[model samples]
Target: MILITGTAGFIGFHLSQRLLRDGEEVVGLDVINDYYDINVKYSRLAEAGIDKNEIEYGKLVQSTTQPGYRFIKLDLTDRESLNQLFEAEKFATVVNLAAQAGVRYSLINPQAYIDSNIIGFTNILEACRHHVVKHLAYASSSSVYGLNEKMPLSTGDNVDHPISLYAASKKSNELMAHTYSHLFGLATTGLRFFTVYGPWGRPDMALFLFTEAILKGEPIKVFNHGNMVRDFTYVDDIVEGIKRVIENPPKGNPEWTGESPDPSTSKAPYKVYNIGNNDPVTLMDFILAIEEELGQKAEKNMMDLQPGDVPATYADVQDLMDDLGYKPETHIRHGIRNFLDWYREYYGYVTDQGADAGAITDQKKQ
Candidate 1:
């Protein structure tokens, strides 16, 4: 059986849907916390045709129409339950996607990262070790490349300096996973994702926030005085990459040496790859995409960069492509349009081509 955490999340939801459509049996787990909107999470579950029977506290139960998907709302931090779940399920492959995911929010509640990302990941590693799971794939972040000014951020590059607590926690995860792989021979792969965005995405993310605010006639805050850049990746491509990588578990690098080691691979059944579009999008261009999708102009209140924020992020996807044949093709304009369509339908927002982005006037050029 294939087990997935954060199955209700954006990437997780899309992945579960894809796997179920392909007739794969999937067992999903999530804590269902009120971090953003529990209703949206539940709605995503319902859309998956999950039965709400046998519900537990803070948990949602789902049985799929595809007859191959099941979801259980459970916290990764609960070690006892996590172990029992792992023991009971006998999952051959485990995708660890659950984490308190936010860069800025990490500055406020740093403990959340420790509990979820660190402690919870530790439990997952131990469970894999004890249960004899063949492979484990977990979500790392491009944030791990913190404070690095390098262009086309490569997984092979050193990721020692991190600017945010979130980045530090992700880096810590890579270290922990390497140690586990070395000691227990568990096949592990860490993906450092850059600015993933698409339909049914997180509310806190830039695309979602920008689309919502612009549609509502509110000024979307353009950070770094409109100088930032991001390797904005589509969720669909990420899920596709993941499905392929899970089947091809990592083998220890024979050429790896302790003196001159590669950060991307280890002698111990461990690997890390950068999953991104590899095309950097300037902040101003991104704003223009939303403006075109909404068919409205945004009132621009250009501001200095925020703390724990990087000026730009560009991913080096050569290793990913050469290894897994992964290619991300969704252009930002198309992705933005898809998201806006979903937003209007899902949220009952009025659809109008004349609708304008709030207060901040733009140097409107798409």
Candidate 2:
């Protein structure tokens, strides 16, 4: 059996749907916290044939649409509950995608990071160790590459300087995974994802925010004064990479020595890979793509870089290609177009309403 955490999340929801469609038995878990919009989370679950009204917290309920899928509302930090579920389910593979995600939000609520990213991840590692799970795959982030002036960030690069608490938490996850892999013989793979965006995505992300703002006739906040670049990856591509990594757990490298250790792979059955489009697009170009898709130009309010925000991000996926024989192949225009299509259809945005985002923001503040 496969256990997927954060099933209500953007990536996790898509991944679970794909696995279920492939006729795999999947058990999904999530807390369904109200980080952004609870309705969106519920909508994703509804798409998966799991009705919100039918859900009972911490109880496994079978999906009405997909015969091979079940879902449980649970938090990772609840060690007792997690262990009990692990013991009962005997999951062969565990994919953890749950965490309090946000770079700037980490600055405001530092303890939330420790609770979810650190403590929760520790619980997952412990559960895997005890349950004898075959493989464990968890989401890391490109933000871990903070302060590195290198282009096309590679897993081989050392990530010592993290400008944000969120980045630090992700880096800590890697260290924790390595220790478990070394001592307990658990096979773990960490994926450092770069700017994942697509249909049914989080409202807090750039694509969703920008599309919403542009459609509403509001000025989109162009961070870094339109100088920032991102290796924007599509959700489907990331899910594909994750499936490949999960199916092929790494074997310990016999030649790996302490003399000159490779950061990507270890003597233990642990591996890390950069899962991204590898094509960096400037913020201006990204906004223009959104504008083109909506057939409306945004009122650009050029802004300086916010705290804990990086100016650029690029991924080196050579290792991913060599090992998995696949790389992310989605183009920016096509991806953005798809997102716009979905956004319009899902939100009933048939025509431009010219709703100003500035007005909405002001009202929220009031």
Candidate 3:
């Protein structure tokens, strides 16, 4: 069985469903912390057939809907419990996605980031080491490329100047994974995810926040005076890439040399890849897509760029395509439309005309 951490989270929930559909037995794990809205997290779990009322800390509950899936309420920092679960389950593959996940919030509570991202990740590594997992994949982030002005950021880029504590924590994860790979010969891969958005996305994300404010007729904050760009990848595409990576574990690069080392690969069984759309959409265009989907204009609250924010991010996904034969292709408009549809249905939202907003036809849908 595969062990997926942070299963109550956005990407993890979608990934769990996909894996279950593909006939993979999955054991989902999450602490169900109240970072954003616990309601959303619970709803995600409910969709996965894990009733919120049935969950108990440190207990495993089988899924009611998907027969191949089970869930456990656990935190990564609790090493003893995590180790016990790993020892009992003997998961062949592990994916670490549970982390205190906000760039801005990291500044407010740096300790939270260290606890979940650092201490927690250490516990995961130790558990995997003792459990003899074949492959381990963990979520890295585009924010790690702090202060990097290079367009189409590649995995080989030097990411030493991380600006936020959150980014620094992710960078630290890559390093820690490499150490385990080199020492214990644990196969590990780090995925640097770009701006991911789609149905059931985090409410703190740009798409969700923009949709919420516009639907409520409130002014939406446009940071950097709307001069920003993101390689906003769809959640489905991100999960697809992850699934591919999980199936194909990396081998040590024989070509790797110590004198001139490649940052993306190592002589050890470790690697990193940037998973993104490879298409940078300007912030204004992204907002326009949301507005078009909602058929409503947003009252823009022009604001200076907040701290721990990047002006632009474009991913060079050539390595991903060359190695995994996959790339994120979802357009912003299509993604926004999908998210808006989910938001409206989940929240019982209606247009000013007392009708549901019409769905936009996605000609690019494949």
Candidate 4:
């Protein structure tokens, strides 16, 4: 069986659904915290046949829709309970995706990042160590490449200079995973994801926020005075890359040497790869894609780059393509359209005579 943490999250939800569709027995875990809108999280769970009303903390509930899937409402910081779940389930593979996400929020509440990303990740590592999991794949972020001006950020690039606490926490996860891989011989892979956006994406994300603000006739915040670039990856493509990584556990590289150590791989059974579109889109162009999809212009609120924000992020996914023989193929406009459609449907918005109109009823606004 496979254990997937953060199953209520965007990428995690999509991945769990995909794995279940592929006939894999899966156990999902999430704390269901009110990080954003709890309603959205519950809706995602409901879509997976795990009713929100049926969820009780620390209890496992079977999916009503997908026979092969089950879910548990558990926090990673609760090591005893996490260990107990691991012991009982005997999960062969584990994917750790639960973390305190958001760069800007990290600046305001650094403790949340430390609590969830650092301490919680340690608990996960401990559970995996004792449970004897075959392979462990976890989420890492491209934000770890902070202050890196290099174009097309590669896994081998030095990421020791993270600006945000959130990025530092993720970098800490990579280090912790490497320690486990080196000492316990636990096979672990770290995926450095770029800007992932699609259906059921986090409301705090740029795409969702932009869509919500645009549909509400509010000005969308365009940071860095619209001079930003990102390797906007689609959620489906991200999940596909993760699925391949989960199946192919890394073997320790014999060619690896301590003299000229590669940051992406180690002599231990540990590896890191950049999973992105390898195609950078400018901020203006990204907004233009949304405008084209919605057939309405966004009221721009151009501003300077906020603290803990990067001006640009471009990924070099050559290692992923070379090793896994896969690359993200979703176009930006297509991805935006998919997200916009889901947004409108979920929030009860509609196009009225060539213009979006309706009460979105966003819980986040409450």
Candidate 5:
């Protein structure tokens, strides 16, 4: 059996569906917190065939659509309950994707980051330690590369200077995972995800916010005076990389040495991979792709870089390629168009004003 935390989340939902389709018995966990919109979270759960009416807090409920999949309304911080779940399930693999996400929100509520990213992750580590799980794959973020002027953020790069509480928590997660792996011989892999965007993505992300604002004729906030870049990875590609990593857990690197250590791998059974497109798209070019797809221009509200925000992010996926023989290949134009199609369909927005589904490729070629 496989345990996937944050199954109600964007990446979690897609991953669970994919695994279930592959005939894996998946036990999913989520508290369904209203960090953004509860409605959206519930909608994602519904897509997983989990009826809200059937959910009993802290109890496991089977998916109505997929028999191999089940979900539990639980919190990672609830250590005792989490341990019991791990004990009973005896999962062969675990993917920890649940974290208090968002860069700016950490400034408003720092405690949320501490509770979920720190304490929750600690609980996960403890459970994995006691239960003897085979492999643990968890989500890290590109934001950990904060304050670095490097072009392509690599796992080999030092991430000691985190600008936001969220980034610090993620960095702490990597450190904590290493400790566990070194001490207990637990196989763990941490994924530093770049700017992931796609259908059913988080509302707080730029893609969702900009799309909603454009459709409503509102001004979309363009921070850093519209001068920024992101390795906007598609959700599917991120999941694919994760799947590959899960199948191939890190066996302690034989060449690792203390005098000259690689930040991505260690003598312990642990590894870190940069899961991204490796293509940094300018902020303006991304917006233009959206505009071309929607056939509408956004009213831009230029602003200075917000506190706890980086000006740009690029991912170096060479390690990922060499290890897993996989790379994210989704282009911005195609990815944006995919998101637009899902947004329109999910929100019941009429397509009369915008180009039809798959027209994003056509517009990109023009």
Candidate 6:
């Protein structure tokens, strides 16, 4: 069976449903904490066909309908429950998507990062070490390349200096994984995800926020004077790439040398790859796409760059393309429209008051 953390999350929920549909047994886990609107998360669980009443914190719920899919309300930091689940499941593959996710939120609550991203991930590594899983694949962010102005960020680039606590925690996850791979010969792959957006996306993300603002006829805050760029990848493409990687597990690099080591791969069966659309879209274009989807014009309030926010992000996915023969092809315009449709239906929103400049400006101050 495959065990996936954060199965109630955007990526995790999609991945879990896909795997189950393919006749694979999947054990899914999530804390179901009130980070955003718990209703959206609940809707995701419902879409996955998991019964709400059956879910228990840190306890697995077997699928009555799908037969192959199961779920549990669980936190990564719960050591005792984590260990018990790992021992019982005997998962052949483990996907670690559970973590304290937002970059800005990390600044406000650094302890959350330390608990979920660092200490919590350490427990996953320890569990994998004892369980003998064939592969341990986890989510890493492009934010790890913080403060670097390098065009088209590559996996080979040095990520020693990270600007946000979120970025630093992700870098720490890599280090911790490498150590386990070296000692226990575990095959660990860290996927560095770019700006991912689509249907059922997180409410805190740019696309969701922009859609909400535009539909309400509110002028959205354009950060950094709208001078930012992101490789906005579609959720379907991301999941396709993930499934391919999971099928073809990485082997240790025998040619790896200590004197001149390659950062992307190691002799200890550890590797990192950037999974992205590889097409950087300007922030203005992104906003325009959202406006088109909502069939409304958005008022723009240009502003300076926010702390821990990068100006641009472009992923070099040549390695991913070569390894899995995967290429992300979904355009932002199409993806934005799809998301807006889901938003209108799911949120029951039918308004066109754009947020006053004063309200959003106050949000920025906080």
| Top candidate (lDDT) | 4
Give the alpha carbon lDDT tens digit for every residue of 267-343 in model 1.
Answer: 89999988899889999999998888788898888889888889989999898889888878789888888888787
Q: What tens-digit string does per-residue lDDT give for candidate 5 at 22-60?
A: 888999999999898777778888888898888988899
After superposition, the stretches of candidate 6 with alpha carbons farther than 4 Å from their true spots are 351-366
Q: Root-mean-square deviation of each candidate, in angstroms? A: 5.1, 3.5, 4.5, 2.3, 5.0, 4.7
- Most accurate candidate by TM-score: 4
lDDT of candidate 3 over 1-366, digit per residue (tens): 999999999999999999999999999999989889878888899889987788999999988889999999998989999999999999999999899998999889899999999999999999999999999999999999999998989898899999899999999999999999999999999999999899989989999899889888999999999999999999999999999999999999999998988899999999999999999999999999888888889999999988998999999999999999998898877888888888877776656624333322121110
Candidate 3: stretches off by over 4 Å: 352-366
TM-score winner between candidates 5 and 6: 5
Per-residue lDDT tens digits of candidate 6, residues 299-350?
A: 9999999899989999999999888888898988888878887776665554
Cα lDDT of model 4 by residue, 172-213, tens digit: 999999999999999999999999999999989999998888
Clashing pairs in 6: 30-74, 216-353, 216-354, 217-354, 218-354, 218-355
Q: What is the model-wide C-alpha lDDT for candidate 3?
A: 0.92
Assess the local accuracy of residue 25 in candidate 4 as a C-alpha lDDT between 0 and 100: 98
Q: Which residue pairs in model 1 clash with each other? A: 51-63, 217-358, 218-358, 298-360, 299-360, 299-361, 300-360, 300-361
State the lDDT of candidate 2 residue by residue for 11-57, as single tens digits. 99999998887778999999999878878888888889997888987
In order, the Cα lDDT scores of the candidates are 0.85, 0.91, 0.92, 0.92, 0.92, 0.86
lDDT at residue 37 of model 2 (Cα atoms): 86
TM-score of 5: 0.95
Residue 111, model 1, lDDT: 92
